[model samples]
Target chain A: MNTHLVEPEIVMAYRDGQLAAGEAAGVRAHLETCAECQEIAASLDDVSAQMRAWTVEEPSPQLAWRVAGRAGKPKGKFWWWHWPTAALVTAVLVVAVLPWKRPPAPTVQTGWLPVGSVRTSESNLPLPPAEPRRHDSVAEIGPQAQARTGQLGGVIGGIVSATPMAAPPTSVQRRTQAQFAMEARRGAAIPVPTAPMIARDATLNLTVKDFASVRDVVERIVRVHRGFAQNLALTYQAGRNNLTATLRIPDPELDRTLADLRYLGKVDQEAQNGEDLQAQHVDLAARIANSRVAEARLKELLANRTGKLSDVVEAENELSRVREDIERMQAQISSMENRVEFATVNLRISDTPPVPAPSSVWRGLSEAGRNGLTILGEGLMGVATWLLEYLPTLIVIVLVFFFPVRWLWRKLQARPAFRLPN
Target chain B: MDLTGSDESLMLEVKQGSEPAFIALFERYARPIHGYFRRRMGDPQRAEDLAQETFLALLKGARRYERRALFRTYLYAIAMNLLSAERRRAAKDRGSTTDEPATSADPDAVLWVRRAVEQLDDQQREVLLLREYEQLSYEEIAGLLNVPVNTVRSRLFRARMAMKELLVTR
Candidate 1:
């Protein structure tokens, strides 16, 4: 027997039959001769025996009854009825969540419609007065006798003419004839203006290094061009100044003025539109002529004192209405002329440059720090808002599902095969 | 009537909703599982609760059962989880307190064994208890503990040596 024996690990492995076959044979051959290693092996076996001696009592019989009672309740079974209910709940959840997910439609601003494009209806025009008729007796009285008698004899003869005067042209028929005559004269006399009556307009989006200086330049340009600036707005912000102004320049000088203004800043965007007002101008002129003729006829009717007193009063009313139409037409013509004379330029100027890269490391670090803090604040606010938005939903979900989930959890923990340790 | 089938077969039947197969499994494992819990916990009632919980888990999880390993290994894994949960619950209850109450039910050989086992570190003690009390093989212990077989062997060897020394000193 060799006094030098194997290590304790090999002895333990040997006793447990965990060693390789060759090693086990070596240890077995060694243990056959070594009492010290045998004693160690005996001691290990003694520990195992000592542990095994701590016998524990079996669980109570009622435990099986309780467990079987739970098992017997048809757990883990797929009830055919659950499918429709689950589908319905899923549908409800999807519908509830959809509105929150859908994005809002953006708003679009449509450009203004060109001037006088919409025609004013003839029905909207003022009524013309009834035309005055020459009395039969006045017709018999020679023009020389009426002139010698003066305006009073003419009026007396007009009233003394007993034969009802031939039916006067209706107000509408008279207006149509007047309009037709005007159109005929327009065709013969003045050739319609061949040059387009354009109302010129432009929009400029400019980025400048100095907004105030640029604005001063704009003002100087307007004055040089004999123009005016209207609807001027200036806004000052943290990083820049914004100026929005509408400038009116003579139509002949608009191109030159726009070219000069472009030198003040970088033009990010520029848009020009020219609306033709030829038809509008022609219509306004015709309407004005017709209204004037109506006014003259009403005045004659009133002076002659034709028909009854009611007729006289009615003629005066028609005169007033015709006067209003004339005034309105005059105003429209004036505005249209002004638009054709001057071009409008809408200028939006900003001095804000794009944020540049940080020049130094410290600047970058400070920027990063500021950005981080901002993000943190925003994130916290976002979280708070999210919690507030969904708090009621969360509460309902917890209230509805908490007990069943807890019960199922407890049941899962009770099952020996499937229960996971906490 | 066919109670003599293998644990896997019985589990398959249980998965198919056979009450008899479930009863057969329950009758076979109830006592061992109870004993497993009773040996580790001081309270018999808690042990019973744990045992019942183990069976309930089995019944509940029957539909998901797959025969990847021995049924006993799976069973003991569940028991281990329950025991771990119980320890965590007890630890939470002892919040901010450093002392732990003695948890042995018996005052004789069981107490001595528990004291000796407690003298080892957590890993060695677990290896020793699973090996000595539950009589799980080294390979089974390795699988259950998620360690390599050699590590299990070394840990069990060290645990035995330490346990032997403690018993001698006591």
Candidate 2:
């Protein structure tokens, strides 16, 4: 082993000047008396000195200027760094930062998770009783609803995660790589039922007058229809509150659940989708069957047939690969069946504060004053926003070109290169 | 920041767009970076281009740099990634090409050293060149390579021994 082929790290550290002063003093003392350590130290020093023979030429002076050009312009073209991108970014900042009191994101890991009911088809259980809604976040929801909602299970990691409204339609059943790896190790092959499978999902967007009651109602409705809130999040904004939840109900109760949830508010939009997974399930089943036969033939070959050591190794490799395929196809089939078993309901509820009536003359005057201050703030914000966005780019540009431009200006004033001898 | 400040502080100035700071850093590492690429490839033009790209990449990513890291290691990390990419491209274009770069008129000594350095294992060679050519400390090499300090020490030791054997045989 090379462990003993050379001196230890102490010798190398001593040669490389990596040791502290006291350690260096000790190594130097040892080096004077020890012959083998002396030889190793001599070898390390000679190799370093000999490597100096391979010298590289100094780079051309043009290299720095080319790098400077590319420092600002990514494409190495000067025109690419013009004012348009900065201007566009400034416009966006003015639009976004002018109204800057953003509702903070939900502080994660503060609250409840689902009970073990998610792992089994307990969809026939009755809805838990309804309770009064708290005018806060999902973190403060009741323990009973907590039992039925909001837990970070493996199923939660693999399912339609809770997301905000106006973002987009949230994707359902997106398994993370970690979850799949865990599933692979667990050897939990989902039993593929010989039945037609139709996976159903829906999105319901509603405008509710009473914002606080909506989460409670949605939870109750999911439970009443034998479904569970796979993931839930409630966001509160000034003069408005948003409740967006991804609910998982049994396929039989999807229509009834959608109906009860709509009664909580005014329906603005509704979308329903049903994807038939029978063809995919059949395809996976056939692939698994074929791989299983191949796996068995290899296993039989390894156990009964005599062959060379290399041939046995090859057969073992092929057998493991075939079993891996069988597991992967079986996992895919299981995932599809799980999707078909529960219908996904994406529920979003929003509220707008009631407009106050002008009961007296002060109301009108107060609103006018507020509006005037808002206009003044926006006007000042436009300039501040532009500076905030473009200041960094401006500094980089000036720094990169400052010396060369200054030299050119000084040269023009002193020599006037283009002028004839006068 | 002045020319005498630590490289990390100079880099902080570079983060604030100080050209003098950038110049100080460039002058400090230009030859080492150029040699880093030049020692590993036969083409001087490609090496020059890659060395320039390292500096440009540094400027492009300067804003995101944290002062906790030594500036030299960060710079070498970029150079290493670029060299890796160049080697991959070269391998696909020309199989089994040697890295015998353009050298001084004294070819026998210089070519012998290059061949000896090249004969070491890839990782061990990296550690040796970083020590001999770039003169990076062991801790810096460990940080740059994302390896343990002990690993860097062992690799550097083995590499130095291997180079000694190869050079003597020649």
Candidate 3:
């Protein structure tokens, strides 16, 4: 074996000046006798010299002119550096810095999930009542009515004997009733003999890949569970989709619904809250009794003709007020009961898909076209929206302030480029 | 010892709108940069064009330059990129043809050296040039090219060995 070929790398080390002093001396001794290694060193030197020969032409004189011209332009001259350029500078600074300053977007985890109810329908057993009011219904009524009315409920039944107003006319009554019902529905002060409920509240944020499919499944689930979607919003984009929904599921099915929702994707967030309204139910029951007693007293005053006209008028007014109060209270009780019967579930579904880079020219063109249109539309819409929102202010400024500013600017521009310092 | 500071001070003076400082930097680096391109390109006109571009680039990029690394390294890095880009464009224009046979007057020693140098691979060629012509230390070359010192050593060694073999064969 050729000794030099045995370790060509050693020759390299020698060339690199990495050889120890002793090693270098030995290499040098070998080199004095060996023509091959010497030739290698010479070749290395020639190669280095050849590599240094790669140079380029001077850029055009026009290039210097272009850069200098751009730098010297009135518009470009320390544009953001002048006090007068504050607004422009702010814009430039934001444009320059914002991209780098922006924090990376939070990564979204998403998957395909069923649109339907996650839980099976369960009985909406009525919730226990909330705390009772301090005053019992019968206790608030006058003693005289208490003796004659056979309970306030019966006494109220007999008063206002003048055709009993026939529950008012449907059109007039419907609106008032609707209003009353709305109040009752919202207030939960009146009791409708609704089924006993197990009230529950659940919040779930999950990821889903197919928003449309999930939405469909959710709707089906709501139907199967005998629940309703109170409010829902779905947003779709090319690479992402999301759905936020408020569902009123039967209280008994809430737990099951939550469990099923978990199957959709990794539950990023979840929460639940519940309260029993049983005591409130009992308190409302007592208030209805007392209102009935007040009605009885007023009816007696109207029917007996034992008091003066003024007294009778006062009594009738009092009776009307009592009955109205009773109706309002009942509406509130009903609303409360309904809420207790239904469990509210706020579900947030996120569909995050990996953004596949456009590979082909056609895809790129299409994407570019879409992006162009979007940017164009967004720009137009942004301008339109800004104009719409601030048009009045802008108009006022143009009339009251901007016209003068413009006139001043024109006057300033008319001045010599080299102006005397103020 | 303070090569970076010297280069930076020169550049700083230039950025302060000093024409002379810029001219000085140009004069100092001109031949080196010219030789750099001249060795690679067969056509003198093209090499001259690239050299001018290097100086102009240095001028325009003066204010933007950061002194995090050696100024020479930075300048050469820019020059290298420009050269590579030009070569790519030329290659593309010529329908991706590489290795057109050199037809130069010095069919003697210079031609022989060019052939032997060209025989080495790209990394080998770069390592040879950086060490022998630029006189960069192994560490400096490694840092400039963003490679390990050992890699630079090995490449340089391979280049020398290859050139040796090629020259001897001739």
TM-score of chain A of each: 0.40, 0.42, 0.39
Query: What TM-score quantifies how close candidate 1 is to the native fold?
Result: 0.41
For each candidate in turn, the interface RMSD (Å) is 5.6, 7.9, 9.8
- lDDT tens per residue, model 3, A1-422: 66674255566677768677998888877878888878766666664555345333443334333333323212222343223345444444544454432223223324433332221122112212222223222122244323323332322221111112112111111123466556543543344334433356889998765455676556544543446788889887666788899997656556655664665566789999876666666677678778777777778778998979999888888988987888877776656655665678999888767778889999999999999999999899989966675566445534554455556545544433221111
Among residues 3 or more apart in sequence or in different chains, the pairs in candidate 1 whose N, CA or C atoms overlap within 3 Å are A414-B53, A414-B57, A415-B54, A415-B56, A415-B57, A415-B58, A416-B54, A416-B55, A416-B58, A421-B81
In candidate 2, what are the lDDT values of residues A1-422, reduced to their tens digit?
A: 44443345688799889988998888888888878788878887787888887777777666665565445433223333434444455555555555544333333221112221211121212223344544332232246434444442222221222221112112233344466566545644433546667899999988776675556556655654446788898897776788889987767667756755654556789999999898887788777767766877898999985999999999999988987887777678657866776788888888856677878899889988999999999989988976776666656655555666556544433431111111
Candidate 3 displacement at residue A152 in angstroms? 66
lDDT of 1 by residue, B1-170 (tens): 57799998888888877767777787778777887777677667878888888987887787788999888888899988988888888888755221222453567766787788777898998888787777788888888999998898888888998888888888
lDDT of 1 by residue, A41-134 (tens): 8998898788887777656667866775455433344332233344447545754675563222222212321111100111111112212322
The docking quality of candidate 1, as DockQ, is: 0.32
Higher-lDDT candidate among 1 and 3? 1
The Cα RMSD across the true interface for model 3 is 9.8
Taken over the whole model, the C-alpha lDDT of each candidate is 0.67, 0.69, 0.60
In order, what DockQ does each candidate have? 0.32, 0.22, 0.18
Best by TM-score: 2
Which prediction has the highest DockQ against the true structure? 1
Question: In terms of TM-score, how similar is model 3 to the real structure?
Answer: 0.36
List the candidates' TM-scores in order: 0.41, 0.43, 0.36
